[model samples]
Target chain A: MLTSAAKTALYGAHVSLGAKMSPFGGFLMPIVYTSILDEHKAVRTAAGLFDLSHMGQLVARGPAVAEWLDRLTVNRVAGMREGQARYNIFTNERGGAHDDAILYRFPEDWLIVVNAANTAKMWELLQASKPAQVALENRTPQSALIAIQGPRAAEILAPLCGADLDGLRSYHALRTRLADGAGGVEVEIARTGYTGEDGFEIFLPAGAAPAVWERLLVAGTTHGLRPAGLGARDVLRLEAGMPLYGHELDEDITPLQAGLGWAVRWEKSDFIGKTALAAQKAADDYDRIVGVVMDGKAPARAGYAVHADGRRVGEVRSGSIAPALGGRNIATALVAKAASAPGTRLTIEIRGTEHPATVVPLPFYKRPA
Target chain B: MSQPADRFYTKEHEWVKIEGQTATVGITDYAQSSLGDIVYVELPAPGAALERGKPLGVVESVKAVSDIYAPLPGTVAEVNAAVEDDPALVNRDPFGEGWLIKVSLTGDASPDGLLDAAAYAEFVRSL
Candidate 1:
């Protein structure tokens, strides 16, 4: 069964129109909006607006909130100033990544947005980790996030929010009142996006989101904004060299091997999985993530085996023939050093047929002008 | 968008433009619309023998990979190279510049089995 939460990753999910429905992140999300290629192009050449309301939102406060958060997360939270956000990780004691989150620091507290499927578990962990003075609350039902992304996204969204958008930069957010009597809503416009374009993610009240979206659609028509689904979002993020949670990193993949070591605060006084990560970093038998380009027409979608010569070398983590890259089969995979070099020759078994493949640098497509 | 009257189509949406023993091949407008923004096509090599209704090639869209079927039996005499370079041509010109392959027909190339423009339009509407 596809729930509302399953719909975020690939927008257009759970539409009553009988499109192929797949359960993703606890919601039913669309793999294609009309068609994957068209949607992808809309984002690449024009602009794409995605409904990312299904991501988890949590509020933690009190004296122990900060301290408890520091003990639980991989990234150091002590340095976060008000109105700032930082990417952090939830890790197991063995150093494997459980999930990733964005920590938004408020003047007196913090809002941690996490993956939909991981929300309950993360909340439970916080419940156990919170000190006597701390309080944790899950606010997923109250918030809806909409992303307006592409080269011309800013120009399209400026009038609606009436913020100083010209000076707005990436990773920065501004909270402001939305339309009058607009369902008791307040919107936080973040100059952040998943499509690797200049765009914004607007966070508003769940009830108010639809109205704001409608207004944006009317306002964004001149800029060619499309209501893109999750399918296009994946291709765009992959093209930009960003990683997906389940595809690139999971409970089995550590932050170090996933090329997310930069997010780990090694110098922090103490944090979960720090010792294990330190030990893993000292040794090397595990694989690291990198891009792969397969030859010929057949693309190696997820769950395909990577082969060196005729033997299994590794597994394809994420795979797609990107639209912007002119239909070349590209992927990210973790493999042993013998098979992980940039120029290493390999093959991917697609439907029992072996397609010629090669290891390439991360990101198959650069930002198009 | 066109559905040339004299051509036959497969359930997979391939169109065969027949002329005596020679039949030009391309995907239908419906197929093009369904596939959307063709990025790369793996066409069967020239002179490769293909059976009717069999997998002849593959098409990669931005989001998914789809297989192409041979609409009629014959050998591939020519494959569109322009599309290999610029797959968007398939979306822009599905009938002319977007044509995929040319095959030499062995025997039957049915005109009765194919839909006229009106019929194809109805087929699309029904879909």
Candidate 2:
């Protein structure tokens, strides 16, 4: 077995705190600090700190960056203003999603944040698709990302940040300094998160990550902040109706099938997979993504068969016992349009037995406004 | 992670305590801790037969789903209803309240190759 894996700057701190470490995204990461339930609840009620350094960050700069990005990703990049971010996908000509990413626009460069496992593939794809005027650099090794997410995120993070976070809306980024106990560090703070809550995703120099992480935990201690892990992160994101790369999305799935049609811009002149995506949308030929709620606590896990009228109609893409939603079993699946209605009945085949489930709306849980 | 000195353990992390022909079974603390918070458990009925070292039931944790194996060939005398209703007991008290099933041994000879407490601790450490 391959024992040695990549470690983040905060690895030592996680070990000291007795975090259960596991392999994820080619790195040995904290799966949980205390328990999955407690960490998950902390994110919903108060605030939770997360180590997201395993995500891939790539920088594209120079004269033709805009045109290069337009051809590279599915979302519209030409109209994105400086300090703005757009969720996008990199796909093949067949309209299959290769990877999903968040594109951040700076004045002189574009930072594309991708899933960690797809980093090398995305880099090679961009290189092959880019024009000579564009310069590509993988800055993941030099950068670190930490997220402080929840209802109390703003109040907990306000004191240490130099930037005015009150006006920073979702998907907006600003470069500023964060005051830490050791020393202040430059960071790009973005008001965005996968947990469906108000939060900030801070990108800072890799060397200063450990200090900044410790300071954030201390600052948010009074606000009920806990060090969360990937286990909790998974349940939170699933409850929010966000799709994971390998689970809800893969090389064979398209953006439209995953209920992410809004990310694609049909008005764009040309881009990779645009032709196929336009065809798919025009014909409305793809299966629709719908939420499934089990009758009780029985969880419908990924790859479980979804049956309608005693016949297999679809398969679960992601499912979990949603903690924020009263620990109910909720799932998302790509099903036929006929069975995708809000009140349609279905059955989830788990351990060779079928359990009754109901087709609900897209997201199982939405944070109160 | 506590393991009682009297019980015998298997490489699969199950513990068995025998008294006469009946044997009580449950997973070890190391097993429950490694699996994280268990959400659901599915066990065989009281009258079902179990083969030694074969799958007996399924335990679904918040992290993943793992199969529980039978340590000795026996007939299940009783299944724990408490654990079926609230699976978190497996994490809270693995030895006492979280015991999965009580089985009546079928054959004369006990299941061989079971590890003692010390050996089980060493096996968990290697993991």
Candidate 3:
């Protein structure tokens, strides 16, 4: 089965570690090394390493690179300073999301990290809308991304990194050297993560990934760093109130409906989906995403019907057992505005039985300051 | 982990330990491992009738929900409350403290369709 899927440079390493390999985003990726619960706890309490090579990395360079991207995405890309990373979303003409992405501004070029599943689509979109001046390149196949996430991330990475780890702020990036055995490997380190933790994501050549991964593992062993997988990553993102591409923000779901209006720059002169998004904002009656906590042991699941006052209102987009919330079942549902208020009683229909759930605020878990 | 030699297994990865007219049922270790972390378990109440190869309850992990099937025809005599309270027991001790249900075998009940320990191990390997 793995033969049909693309393998990362760490494929052999993951196999040797007895990781459960599964297909994700067109790649044969590790789903878990030991158990999801153990890995999730490791990321929360200590630190966890992740193979993010499957994500897409697109590089664009030109004088009008940021300006052209500003017209295509829903955020202010042109105003971004060098070494800054901003979360942005590409939307369709109808205000539907094409993909949620992070744009990292460099001195000479911009690196856009997109969802792996949307890599092909995003590349086509960029090329079709590209002007004569902007040059676009897909670096995903040649690049590998590794992320060390959690409270001990900086402590584990400071010794190996040449850049000032303590000085790096969140959503900032720097091109630096990672200490290898004899020489240094040039890499880009970004202090951004989907897990809502203090972390750093390293982007480097694919050939350099395995060695870096092993080096980090060796250095992090005493710090309780474990190799987490996609299963744990999914749980962590959900607990952090982050959105997954297919679940929370798809082609039919807009940034406004997903509670990401802040990512949408309405003040921008002109962008795709501006008109429709403006109308949706004016109406303010669109069905929106809300956080839910089930009152029973049965966990809510994606596509489960959500009902309020005996009427079908929405369906769950993503659901999982939230370890941060003490093993309680949590979910995100796209429901009508009337049912989106916090403390609103809602019911999730599971296997023809209605289970009690309450509408709470987004972000089921928050890191202590 | 090795399957208990005294039990009969099903193709769906369920194990049944039969003694006299009573049978204890639980999922195999492979099933629990494949399901990852177990967070919830729903079972039938005592006195519910179950047929062979029929859905009995659900076992939910953080990522997925799997249906647990009955191994033989029986009347549910008791349910394991420990698992419903702490579902991780199914992942920790799947055969012992994680036993899902105990059933009184029906009059026509038979283990004809079930496989023994060796056969079940081979079946798992074939997968």
Candidate 4:
């Protein structure tokens, strides 16, 4: 029990053995000052602050910025508006997903926040694979990221950052100040989040993050912002039916096969893998991605087999208990063409047992109005 | 709290109580807390051989799937069926109704390979 020291120590009271807890992302973090379920429920109802400093950010600059990026990514980055952000995929020439990124364009350079797990590999790929003219630098060491997300997120962040965030619209970003400083590093706050809840990803120097974290926690306590960890982050994204990169989209799978074809700018005249993408589109034989809602008590997990007529049809790529949509099991699976349609009945193998399931439209959950 | 002083513990985080040759086994409090909420537990059959340190059954929580290792080698076991239905039994009564199975001790229920409450407490502390 984490509460072990509190009841035992008399002066451990003053010097309570604050837990050195290690958890998600290979870091020991606090599970809760309270409980896991309580922290999970808070984000569903109100707002929560998460230390997402582990996520990686890369800056791309130099002469072939537009031309090289447009070629390297599946999405259209060349036509991106200033201060706007877009979710795009970096892929191999074979069209497999190398990384899923949020591309941010500023006046000086373009920044892409990538999943932390892919940081090293993505850097190596960019150095070896991206055009010779594009200069890609890993800026993760210098910055930290924070997510203040949920229904009241905008309201909480608005007064502190002092930017017209309401008018900023979704997927927009701007350079904003915390305490009015001109001689030092600046913070760039973006309206981006891994959680489906509306939120902002505030970027600042790594050394200055703890102060901001403390301030936000103090400022947010009045607004019911609990300090949530990666556990709640997993549940939130699962409920929102968002796909995690390693789980849903991987190096072996193409974005088109993962139901992200709409993001590929085929209308653009040229891009990397354009010839292969065109051929795949012409073939149209890809086994597409779809959502599966389980019909039994079991939670489907990664590598669990998806079944059709007692035969293994596919495997669950990512699965979890959907917190927002009650306690039912939800999964994203890559099933065959016929079974990929909504309303198609399927089965999920949990452990050794097969439970009835069905193909549903993407996103088993959506934000309430 | 540290491991209860009166209880004996297996290295795999299982705690046991033996009366005669029949021994009761359940996950330690530290195990349940680490596994988060216990969502499902697979209990062994009434007459199956289980070797010490070998997996006797499976326990799936919201966070991870764990192999419930045999506390002591034995044969033919009675299971706690309640956990199969309401798996939270491990969280609620980890030492009582939360017991996974009763095993008939095989070799020595010897003290050498096991940990006392003080040692288990120290071991968990090091973790």
Candidate 5:
């Protein structure tokens, strides 16, 4: 079976490290190194390195950049100052999500990072809705992205970074160089991560990825850093209560129904999906997202039905045994508004039997401040 | 990751050790590695009857869920409670303490259709 899926710059490195590779989002990505549990725990306790280059990078520049972005996403893009990043979603006319993206403000252009699977679709959407004055370019292939995330992330990268990693606040980014043991290699460092822990995401030239990835692994060897794969990343994000595009937010699901109503700014005068989302907020009558913890050991996988009062109430969108939570079976579900309240009792149908579960707060885990 | 020479293997990646009329069954080394981090295992209770090529239990890893099939027609004689408590034992020792269940033979122990250690090793290589 031959696959035409694209490979990242670190493809050979992953194979050399004995990683289990699988097809994900149009790319052959590493799913695990040694084990998902070990990598998941390593990120929570020490540090973890991730290759995020498969994600799409779109840049829109010119004086109309801010105005164009304001009409494109759900968040307030105009308010973002240079060096700041904001998380937002692109919704269709029916208030359904196209993709969740991170927008970073720079002096010349607004960099939009989107999910790899939706890169082509997002590019077409941006081009069709773009203002004539604004320029749109897909920079995914030209750039490489890597993230070193955990409580000890700064301690591992500080020695190699030329800038002050300590001063950089969350959601802030800076232009810096990494010492590859010989000299400074130009890169961009952003204090952001999907895991709910302190970390830095480095963006550099695609050609420099292999060298930098090796350098970071060596630099963090004493800090218990491990090469984490997408399997660990999924569990980490789930534990942090983050929503993935395909699993949690799809074309049929809106931000409000997916527990992302906060990201949709009703205060904005006008934007895409503003009318439909406003109607949803006003009605407050639709099914909404809820976090649930199973009373038993079995995991409630996606598409599993949820029940209450012997009737179907909803379905699970994302779930797994939270390794950080000592292998607790946790999941996020879209249930009826009546069952969305925290502490509400519900039953998740795992396999063929109903398992007792309770509606809890969104985000089963949060980093201690 | 070595297959014990005394055990018989199934094409679906199951291993069986038949001693007289009692047979101990578990997954092969390749199956455990492919599953990655076994978290839970659901096995049949003692006295339950199972037919060959039928699902007798379920083994769940962090990545996926797989069915554990009965190698031959038999009734459950014993179940490994230790695996229910700590599923990692299946990954650590697939042929020893990790054995899923022991079944009492109700039909002819069909050793004819099963693969020995050498043949099973070749089958894995062909995959």
Candidate 6:
């Protein structure tokens, strides 16, 4: 199955670390190094390193870049200041999400980080919709992204990074150099992450990734920075209430339906899917995503039926044991608005039996300030 | 890890130690290791009938779930409360504390069709 999948520069390092390899987003990715629970706890408590090179990096330049992109996505792109990053979503004609992305504004260009699975689709869409003044480049293959996440992440990275780590605010990015053995490599350090913790995502050339990875590992030994994999990443993101691409947002699921109305800028003059999104927002009766906490020990899985009042209401979109929640099972389910209230009672059908579950708030976990 | 020579094993990685009319059943070490950090276990209740090669319970890890199969036809005499309460026991000691159920042997309860320890070790290698 992995014969045709592409591998990142850190693939050999992962194999040497005895990571369990699996095919994800057309790439041979590490699912776990030691244990998912251990890695998940490390990210929550101390620090965790991630090889996120599989995510797509698209660069857009030219004077009309922001304006052009603003018309394509649901968020306001042109209003973003340089060195700022914003979460946005590209929607289709029906206001359904094409993909959720993070847009980083630079002095001369814009960097859009997209989901790995949507790389090809987003690239095609951007190329097809490009105006004469916009220059679009798919830099995914040439770029590598490494994220250090946890409460102690900044402490672990401060000694090696040349940037003012203390001054960098959240949702911001700065071009800086990271010291390697021979001089250093130019990198973009972004104080942003999906793990709902204080962290930084470093982007650099693919060729320099391995050395930087090794250096970070060596420097992070005292802070308990273990190389985490996709399994832990999924659990961390889910607990943080972040919307995963295929689960919460998809071609058929709009941002509003996925509880991402905060990202949609209604004041934007014109954008793709604006009409449909406005209609849905105005109607406010669509089936939507909600958090479900299982009252029993059984973990609700994706595609499991959800019931309310003895009738099928929705289905589980994602589920996992939230180690942050003291091993309680948590899930995201798309259900009718009537069943989406915070205190609503629901049942998740696991094999042939329905287990009791209750609707709660979006995030099942939050780090201490 | 090597299988215990005193018991019999099935192709599905379940081991059974037949003692008189009773049999003690649990998953092999290879099975627990492959499953990875079991978080929950579902075993057949006491007095439940189990057919050979049929699913008797489930073992769930953080990312996946697998069904544990019966190695011999029998009625469940007792279920392991230790494993059900703390699933990590299956990963720590699959052969001892993680035993799933104690069964009262039923029809054709002889271990004639099961693989002996030497044969079972060879079978695992072939996999």
Off by over 4 Å in 1: A2-47, A117-134, A155-159, A162-169, A180-184, A221-227, A293-300, A308-311, A321-329, A343-360, A363-369, B1-4, B17-24, B105-127
Per residue, candidate 6 scores C-alpha lDDT tens digits across A74-114 of 99998999999999999999999999999999998999999
- The lDDT for every candidate, in the order shown, is 0.77, 0.89, 0.94, 0.76, 0.90, 0.93
lDDT of 2 by residue, B51-115 (tens): 99899999988878899999999999999999999999999999899999999999743757999
On DockQ, the candidate that comes out on top is 3
Candidate 5 lDDT for residue A96? 91
What does the lDDT read for residue A159 in candidate 2?
94
Interface RMSD of each: 3.2, 1.0, 0.7, 1.8, 0.6, 0.8
In candidate 3, which residue pairs clash?
Answer: none
Error of 5 at A203 (Å): 1.1
Candidates sorted by DockQ, best first: 3, 5, 6, 2, 1, 4
- All DockQ scores: 0.36, 0.73, 0.91, 0.30, 0.86, 0.78
Q: What is the Cα-based TM-score of model 3? A: 0.99
RMSD, candidate 2, Å: 1.6
User: Model 4: which residue pairs collide?
Assistant: A21-A28, A21-A29, A22-A28
Model 1, A138-206: lDDT tens digits are 877677788898887877877666578887666767777655235335778777777878788887777
lDDT of 2: 0.89
- Residue B37 of candidate 2: its Cα lDDT? 88
Inter-residue clash pairs, candidate 1: A5-A27, A6-A26, A6-A27, A6-A28, A7-A27, A10-A230, A11-A230, A13-A30
Q: Which one is best on TM-score?
A: 3
Candidate 5, number of clashes: 0
> Order the candidates by TM-score, highest first — what do you get?
3, 5, 6, 2, 4, 1
**Native-referenced TM-scores of chain A, all candidate models:** 0.91, 0.97, 0.99, 0.89, 0.98, 0.99
Q: What is the C-alpha RMSD of each candidate to the true structure, in Å?
A: 4.4, 1.6, 1.1, 5.7, 1.3, 1.4
Model 5 residue A165 lDDT score: 89
